[model samples]
Target: MISINNLTFEIGSRALYDEANWHIKPGDKVGLIGANGAGKSTLLRLIVGQYAPTSGTISMAKDLKIGYLNQDLLSYHSDKSILYVAMEAFERQNQLHAEIEDLLAKLETDYSDDILNKLSDRQLEFEALDGYNVEFKAHEILAGLGFSEEEQKRPLATFSGGWRMRVMLAKILLQTPDILLLDEPTNHMDLPSIKWLENYLQAFDGAIVIVSHDRYFLDRIIKKTVESRKGKLTLYAGNYSFYLEEKELRNELQANQFKNQQAKIKQEERLIERFRAKASKAKMAQSRIKALDRMERIEDVDDDNPTVNFSFKFSKPSGRHVVTLDHISKSYPNLEILKNTSAIIEKGDKIALIGANGKGKSTLLRIVAGADNQFEGKSEHGHNVSQTFFAQHQLEALHLENSILAELQAFAPKHTETELRSILGCFLFTGDDAFKKIKVLSGGEKSRVALAKALTADANFLALDEPTNHLDMQSVNILIQALQQFEGTFIVVSHDRYFLDHVANKIWYIEDKEIKEYPGTYQEYEEWASKRLVKTEVKPEKKVKEEPKVKKEKQAPSEDRTRLLSKKNKELSTLEKKIEEQEISVKDLEQKLADEAVYSDATKLQETTRAYNSAKAELTHYQEQWEQLAEEIMELEND
Candidate 1:
């Protein structure tokens, strides 16, 4: 329930919004859609009073609770657990709870009439604000956002950028505000988590104004679409799909009107040119010119045509088999992710790795790409295999000092400047954008540049993890098309449902520490999963157990699968012990280094320093190996 009347917001010389009149009615789940700099997020900021509009008014109902979530998670709270951070959304209620506690404590010693009155007032406020259900609601929101119960207890500072965003999102949702202003809320969420958010938002009370590039997310949640362009806010009375359809029709009509007006003006201009010398026709020509000049001209609608075209420059093909995993069992000291999982990737396979968050999809991809070799698995690459690996953190690996063009040229030294620019254009980096330093680029821009670099690299095997995470719908479509046409073997780990369905011929569903390959697109896999979910399960009930279900290892410990699992577990245990011993040695060496007696004796100091340095180096080595094992185990446990 917000209203904007004659709103004008300017940034330096540019007016982002010009005399815009808009009404955000009650229960309006609005998707704010526009180009990168078209002020979608700016609108949210203006509404939230982050910055004042140059003119006009954005008025809302009195005392409206507004929860605003933008890109503001950079400031880390070192001591706050994820749960505590989320629970802080109920700040007012929490304060009341604390005040009530203080009052109760005061009553234990001595109580006055004023103190008792204050306590009742505070308790009433807490009850009114649902203070008792605060923790439960916080946990529910956190869990929906993919944070595990254990992860909830972890400090907020320990998480990466994506996870930290989830924590922020959980905080916003837990606030239960009357209005939610979220900008790119699903940017860091996995597919399942995105789905969970969509479901949550569907039933969310209050008004919602979201700015996102996720088409599917908007389609599922938004009821009204608001598009901003050229300092105008245009409303469409439907979802994203309906917006697209209606926009096309409106543009076509506008184009026709503009064209017709142009044709009539051209005719009038030609008439004036032809009959100006003739006095007889001069009168008629002057009248026609006056009429033409008086007519209001219709401007052409803004074009959103995506001009993207590119192809992957794959080198010679690899052998018939691209890569193979033989009885692979990757584990950490705490958990096992892949338990004797085996899969053969062929030379022409376009596999989409699909699963919930923390599944071994990305790990398995890295293992195959030869980026991570610590896992206990027999992974073999076929003959003449040339691979380009794009991890989800691929943007972080970019050379920030170099310009986008320079970065590309560094990777492809032989390619001409013109050719590099052309490929960059296909990825939406055009003209002067090619010269932009990677350090100055936004997250989405960095992602696009990374994608451009990966696609342009001379490789026959591509291992991309979440490649479409920051891509817009148009860019994603282009990427899908390019990947489809590329004559190379690729394994892509992605959560974008449309991208997966379009580009993948084989689906690898990694669940329960095993890879189940299906010979169909992701859509087909979804259909199969849906049917399986509805199928009657045969396991005995926990309350009334009729019989025990069969365990399907197919053999005893004599089997190779069993032996492989045993070996993996043994390796994990050994690595853990080795790391622990090394850590102790490092700590002991540090203690020796700290001793004043060792420093006083020069020879003893030198000896102790050498021992300390050597132990620290050895400890670092053991810790790395231990980490890889622990990472796999942690993933499996979380999954």
Candidate 2:
């Protein structure tokens, strides 16, 4: 659908792309992956003609429609109703419908030949575009995007920025453009809505190019990954997982090639040096020197190695119970954020708090961390439970006036300036970068500094809210590993599936005004969710019928025994399948949920959550049945 040829773009001295060649074909689901500052978004803009390339051309077929969604730029007014804005995507249809209506009205009268010809032509055009079903299609798209029937009728102005983005997404999805460009699309979506989007995109009949940090989202949706690095693009076939494996293999090969080339160049240089020292071999030495000069230098492939070593050394173990909440309820005016919630954090426990946006996951974290205390329930930190709270806004809470070095040094242990600078360097703040004011730092840089500060506190109980925000995959992985090895208790609120799966042993899911605990990894939680969905879908209705006591007694044993055995077998099979499916679903959801685009679609997320919950419930029921069946089988065998 679109072709980028010999593209070169630069901002001052930093070249974002150099002679980059990339193409987006019809029905292509391409994921743009790269390290922070690698210009994945920039490349997207170049493709959309939002910015002109310094050199080369971006060519597109005539009349090719494109829909681009940027993270920071959304044109929406709160005053307009959500449905009205969404309906605008089919404005052409709406206009045609109106014209057809007007033409029909004219048909009722004795119209001139010119008017008749115009009316007939308009009718043909309207029929060809399926203008009759435009309203129905718009409604379908809006509902799919998670906009409630009532909310869709409400003015867009009443919705928050996140909801506004959903409205924007609904518009684009309804438009069904030839090419879709999305950046960080999933930042605001919940799990249920994300699943809906996955299904939608699976059936999307166009090319899609998205930039996201969510590995699960990419793995599930993308067929190819275009990685930007060091002013070049590398294409990897298959999903994000495939890309990771293939990229590692390619990097290894590149490293080996670089080593071999260096070795050969070094040997040649040695021989040339030796030969040059001999007068008789001076001519040969000169020829060798020329050859060395003419040889193209082997370039090193860039790898996203973790810059910071975030190893935490806890000074002492805390009490058995890290933190406890009892009968906790919180509200903002009439809005009840959380209600009668109770939870416990035991020593060495890693818990993930998950919920929709504004569902009070963060509020719950705050109450546990003692940031907010005006609640109905009691929150108590166990003896010696020294806690460190990393809020989502920690990046913004830093001392902006202080230099990066000064900021870290203020909280850092008393050490030499050089040592302090070295610590800063580990987080990618090196040389004069340490002198840069904290206020001047980018969102990612500020996050790193905040993390550095949190690490220095030496807290035994860590409560982090969205710590993975503004961090690239490399940084997120580093943090994940650090948390995995840390002995401290961790309670985190994050949407980053990879990080959650890697570190969390339990999940506290906030849904339908309740917080439910799942005692397992993300994979197990997914199984439980899937089973729940199955139960809901295939629930058997109860029937009331009178029967004679003698007849009931006679039929009960056989029926009950057969039903029990059949149910047991079915449950066991379902459990086994769920275990396998959950493993895959968790891995898939974790990857895609991390993508920025998937998060943006509230409707899709709502659907995904529904599907996920169904799967989870079904799996949980099956697991319980399987355990019971195992016991029954053992008893029967023993008898």
Which one is best on lDDT?
1
Q: In candidate 1, which residue ranges exceed 4 Å CA deviation?
A: 76-78, 111-125, 301-303, 536-639
Candidate 2 lDDT score relative to the true structure: 0.79
lDDT score for residue 354 of model 2 = 86
**lDDT (C-alpha, whole model) for all candidates:** 0.84, 0.79
Candidate 1 minimal-lDDT segment of 10 residues: 546-555
**Residue range 342-403, candidate 1, lDDT tens digits:** 88999889999888778777788888888878877699999988889987577888999999
- RMSD in order of candidates: 21.2, 11.9
Question: Alpha carbon lDDT of residue 270, candidate 1?
Answer: 89
Q: Estimate each model's TM-score.
A: 0.81, 0.81
Best by TM-score: 1
